[model samples]
Target: MDKDISEITDKWKNMNQTHIDTDEKIGPYLDKYFMKYKKTIYDSALSLFYALDTRNLRKSHKHEPISIQALKCFKDFVDRNQATIEEAFLEQKVILPACQFAIYRESETWISTICKYYHVESLPKADRIRLLQKTVNEKKFSSAAWFAIYAKVIREFNLQDIYVPLICQTRISVVEQLMKQDPAIAQDVVACMDKYIDNAGELASFARDIPGANFCLLNDKGIAKFAKRLAREYKVPIQICPRIDYNAKMNAIKFLFRRRYEQRKPMDKRTWETMIDSVFDLDSPASEDNNLVLELIYDLTNYQQYEEARRLAHLHRIPENKWPKLLLSNRSSPDRPLSRLGSGKIISDRNPKLVSVEPEKYSVDLPDDKIFYINSHEKFKEMNSYITKHPLLAIDTEWKPKLGLLNECNPKAALVQIACQDRIFVVDAVELCRDSEWATFVNAIINNPNLIKLGFSIHNDLRAISELIADMNIETKPESFIDYAQFHKSLVQAFKIPLPDYPASSGGLSKLAYTVLGKYLVKDDQYTNWAMRPLTTDKIIYAATDAYVLLEIHEKLESWCQERAINYEVLMKALLKKDSTKNKVNIK
Candidate 1:
């Protein structure tokens, strides 16, 4: 026994000397210490662990037999190597062993480490609860340590055997911490506590022990029976039952605000106050829906509570754009549209801001020999041949204008016009959508890497194509496509052109044609129903012009960009990158 003790002490001294002389890493020192003193190192291991720089042990690691000093030391390690430790802990193999170490240690810090490292789903229920129990039971009843351990145990191991008993015995401080950590667990814990307390007298006794036991937090999930029992016992009726269902309250508030706005219903101060009180709880979450909150701010403007409205806006985190500043600025005046002439209708259209182009300046007389109407499979094959022959094709889709109520109309493409050099083919969308051959041919063209598809507002056309494809249960996206609208924007930005301002998704065929071809593409039949069969000659020519003009504009734009020393390839790539980013879902 004396020999073993001497050997352990010598190993510790040597380890310390090595550690001090050359700042050695922890893993290497531990490896050597255990190897040399493997047989009798159990008693001296803690001392050796303490002697070395404890900074090597990451916070994610479950360092056993936790002391205040060790915990403090481990915290520093956690701070320094957080990302690395977190990454390693994410591995499935790493979690089990770390959790096992935490269990063996029977430590509050270790249990927390497990919770931090492994998700509840990743952990085995039996092992997690067992470790939780070991750590929690080892903690002293009334310290900060106990509160932390109890909270972790309750959160991590909510199984009835472990959770119910611990929650019933736990003091209010620990319960409060648990509630703050996870309100859902607090709900469960309160329910369990109520079950154990049984009669009103016993519950009152528990409440007396901890005066700050706020039972209001647990006023959810039919636990109202327990709350009512306690209230009856106290004779004050604490009014904890029928707790504010936040989501339902928000929905109601949103509906009311919508009605007030749409119906132009004047809401009185008393009614507004009642609406606010129903949704707003001083103790509960203040901000639920920013839209409804913004509406509430506007309503508050009617009440002349400007400062209070601003304060509420800030609390709800409503965006600065939605602040109702204009409404607030004109709060005293009657809300009505002003016109130059009294009782006269407001003419919305003013003088055209865009530079007008003559049709004859850029009109091309199409050779009747090349332009082919491809409605049948035979014409489609001939069009496919033309598509294969050409490296680039200008494409356009015309859809029937969706009419009627916004929600009732079904919109679809009526014409798909493809222009390849000399040949222009107008495929009937309604007829072509039914043919499997047409689907395969269309897929080939759209997905071809060698062929470039040129269009104006390409996303709109793509969306129309996607909708049509969905009807046939075929999914496709144009692989090599350029939106002239996107290109024009990038060109203006890159070349510093002094052109008239054109809104995004609006700088379409007419704008491009006017800018590049020096001619306005006529849009007389633009909104006409393209889905009607026995199509007009004027409609066919209109559809053909829209497709053919894209190629002309594209060539002109490319040449114009290249002449100015702008890297056309790099510029298009940048524009496409911007387009792709713009298409991404903005989640707010």
Candidate 2:
């Protein structure tokens, strides 16, 4: 181990030295450290190199004592030791910051060295341009060097036509950095980009690749021109990546702001008129019968144009039926045909049905009062009265735990839905905190051991809820509870129940509910903004059903356990003693 550590340290020192080092020599060091102390040493070295490089850059700038002769000497040293530098950079021996510095300071040299070292005689023109642009803009390389590289690639590869596409996809910071260093090169690249790639979609994709390409600022005239060009170049119904599309739209908006800021002029009358027309054109009219309005709302919402989104949503009454389909459609591709059809009809492979079961309907009567939206004392009193009357509460939470700020670490729970025998209460936890009475009422339900709190995998929900209320000085009892998962697993094992053919491990409480109770629960609103005001009917229904289905599932599982003479107490005890330690084995 000592020998291994010494060898690793020596290799690192050689790599970081002023002169270049050989990969053959450094290889053993990298292998030893990466193999021995993979995460710790590697990460620490990378971080240290980054900080040192930044410090060096700042120091070099401050102490301009180094003459042109010294600079040339340093350049000569780099050139002479090019092989070692190239090896170190390629092997990632220099760490990220130093590597970035090398890319910025000596991109052409690095690229040439890398190509030669790898025996890659030629690279795709677009890739070459991308690399050059990334190095120039991202690493703050000189404009002269950037243009020199750009010109050489274009001339050597005969890539004049593709230059615009490359430029369009190049980062704006690179452009700005190049312009700051040398405006002539920046102007040339901009001109090249403007000359080619006339289509909006292509332009959008290009802008998407570029760090700061804005698509939203393309005025009516610009869009009309691009749209016309796109029609000529590509087929109708163009497919685009949603993330890229979103970025392009954002960029366009930024472009508008930039135009206003730089040009110091208001939008022209024609442009203003076109903006209104374009927005309206994007909206669905009664005659079209399409959810164009909804699309517009989605676009506006995504762009954070809250007022415009709300206005369009209201104007269209954005039918709830269309929203889910539209949202899913935007995210995923239309299904492809399966080899065999259940009905025995040989379906075409081009367009297959993306089948998802329609959510099941429930007949439980809920109060007309919008308890989810309003944080009122009266609403809390009414909800508390309802819960007390039917104290046997079935609780569930609908939250995108993975989507929260903390994500894997500390996830926030929202929309704590509780169902009694008949009524279902979709409580907005976000709003509930605002009302002191609502908080008090929720605390009562959480603390009451006599309530018989039932849920499938209620442990997670309990943990999350406890963490949330911990700030309020409310201590929740972790002991008194029932877990449906443990109970169901026990019954399945005891009876040797036939498992379904689907992926065994993937199915959780929802699948268990479907298998046991023969009911489908809606999970659509599970990821929705449960904290949003004016909770929709769909959200309410989805939330309520989650808790309600758990109640039914628990009852069914319990009865099945009893019938099979499964030890319910043992199962409960096993669940209670279940190891919280992630890597530890559960002895129970």
Candidate 3:
């Protein structure tokens, strides 16, 4: 054991270092060289990095100067190999630094790049889109043509579900062109506006960044049809006026509606009201605009109970009222032909057995769309369409009834209910008492010799109506206004029909209804306060029911006359000609 020390020492010696110890030798030498000339080496390495790595150099020397020669050389390299670099970018060069070296010179290049990027199959769709987003962030494009391309690409990539309003924002204007080229894109544009704007947001906010307003969206045949559809879909003030050939069919202006959020619940009454109000924007509607409001509402409430709602054959009757006795023809417009329905709607069409056995059933059985509360001029204007569409009207007046005989302060008819074939308008007598325009329109409509107006005990009502309409100084009553009371009397006498329980119109509209149609007007409330603002729902229902029932009563009485082989039109004319003082009727 003691003799092994020499062997161990020899073995250790034989395993000695044959190669140079590079780490040991070089450590101090490098330290001595770099320590002596450290600044020069550091500067040289940094300069090389600045020349080669323009990205990081740009970051570090953002406010400082770099080598101009290096920059020039790099620019020269990019310029000389521009095509090669872009081609490489095309061939799946996923490196973004190569992109920066290439396309960030200006935004038009970015726009061009985004359009070209759509076809670069080498890169994945997501990556191409990411690059597009980077470019988009650099500059937002305001070119309509570029927007149209996006409208195309959006469908191509099927990104429509993500950007609905933006799709509607961009695609609506260019839909006709896009449709002919790629029907999928045009239809998608239409589909993008599938949901009602529904108080999504205010118009000003939606138009926050109108991309290409300076450009005309479209001015062709498609635009009117497109604008009409948009009018059905519009909300913003920009949408209120789609100025084209107003007569060139109905067109809707493409308004950029920015969605606030996708509300996924039923709206409250107020919200629902606002939504309907916006869609039926009437005050600034186009001169030749379709009766879009009535048409749409008719559809919404087009139930079996109110089958008359579907009576608008073309939804094309509004502007036709400019001529009270406009000749019915197979063609109204030069290019597009129009026709009238063979059997026009009448009060009989609205007769749906609406009367209830239960006395407490208070509602008028009318959808909110069927009732127009015309408190403002806007609402009055909205009703003008219905007025034009259906000249035959049923009318009634509501006044704050004199509480006592000493009440010398004569209350004007607080409101007047005008019931046409399909809708009821409650005109605010108080609000419009001084509006000369309102008086003039009312005068013209009432005096339209061809119109057939129906009312019960209308003598006092016509006088009240004239007084309420301050300016026209209506010296005479409505020329064609027929008193339902006298008509019933004429029907009973001329046709020898059975006498009703209530013989006199003085018995009231309710008793008269009960006598004629078996559907008495429900007493809304015992205490009548008609002059109240925001008239109570019960009051509105009652008022509308009163006037609307006059038409119903007349329909039943006329049918009786027809059944009895009596000429109802001649009977009505005799009733209109006769005075209340002489309670006898003469149809000759």
lDDT of 2 by residue, 1-588 (tens): 445545544444554453334334444444444335423432333443334344332222223211222223334434554544433223333232333433554444443333333223234456545555565455243432443343344333322223333334343444343334333444444334333333456656555555444566333346444333332222222122222222233344444323322232333323322333332324423232244455555654443444444444555566556554444344433212222212332322212233244324332345544324335668767788768666467877765333111002344566677777666777677766545654555556765645656677777787667655657766665434556656566556656755443222225666676567654443433434454556667667777767777767766666766776766555545554553212121322
Q: Please, what's the RMSD in Å of model 1? A: 17.5
lDDT of each: 0.53, 0.46, 0.47
lDDT of 1 by residue, 1-588 (tens): 334334433444554555433123333434444445434333233344343334242222232222333333444544554554434324545555545444555455555644463443455556555645554465322322332343344455534433333333434444444545554654554455444322434444444444244444333332334333332332321122122222234445655443323322233333334445445544544343455577777865654556656666767666767777765475354433222222222232213443243233344457766677878877777778768778888888988653221112245677888997777888888877776655766678876756777887777777777777776766675666777766666567656755543323233577667666666666545655576676777678889889999888777777876787766666555444444324221211
The TM-score leader among the candidates is 1
Ranking by lDDT: 1, 3, 2
Evaluation by lDDT, superior candidate among 1 and 2: 1
Total clashes, candidate 3?
5
How many pairs in model 2 have backbone atoms within 3 A of each other, for residues 3 or more apart or on separate chains, i.e. clashes? 8
Pairs of colliding residues, candidate 2: 137-174, 214-251, 214-252, 215-251, 215-252, 216-252, 217-252, 284-293
* Worst window of 10 by summed lDDT in candidate 3: 253-262
Better of 1 and 2 by TM-score: 1
Candidate 2, superposed: residue stretches over 4 Å from native: 1-375, 385-391, 400-411, 438-443, 463-470, 499-506, 567-588
